[model samples]
Target: MALSKFGFIVTGAGFEPAGKRVVLSSEAFEMIAVGVPAPADALVVARQLASEGVQLLELCGGFGPVWTAKVIEAVGPGVPVGSVGYGPESIDVMHALFKA
Candidate 1:
């Protein structure tokens, strides 16, 4: 089936999901992007998007494997969930960018 709607969740400090959301759309597709302060907040957001008829869900690399799995389970099996992954070459750069 063709994709009509998509949802993406990104994480960063000070990001509030409700206040930091945007929707971009064209004739064929609509994509919703939301920002969360932490990975745990993504669970609620993921379930919300699934109920809102989002066909696919993707998480930023910050979500990582554990949170990605949590989101998938939170959204259940009906919605497809995926996460971004950085290659080995990007490890140092990513670490530097997100270091506390």
Candidate 2:
């Protein structure tokens, strides 16, 4: 993906203690990743990413509609909000599922 700015709110991982803030950045590779645990961490991460001026906010796949709403609400209405699946980009899949 050729994204100049991107944000993904994540939860749970194989790392010890599922709720520690995760940050990885490679100046040479020019890649950065911020992972946050579920529930409480979502809002905090959302605000932080918004502060960092992310053009797009993509929720992790584990986030359902309710959690999605919470994250959106936390990020406010300025920046565009979406998710890994079942979002506008996944309309084709959604339509196929619905038509079945």
lDDT tens digits by residue: candidate 2, 1-100: 4555666666665422233444444552222245665555677777877887776788767687888888889989887888776558887875785473
C-alpha TM-score for every candidate = 0.94, 0.62
RMSD of each: 1.1, 6.6
Distance (Å) between predicted and true CA of 46, model 1? 0.4
lDDT of candidate 1 over 1-100, digit per residue (tens):
8999999999988998553889999999999999999999999999999999999999999888999999999999999999999899999998898788
Q: Sum up the clashes in candidate 2.
A: 0
Clash pairs (backbone) in predicted model 1: none
Model 1: lDDT equals 0.92
Clash pairs for candidate 2: none
Best by lDDT: 1
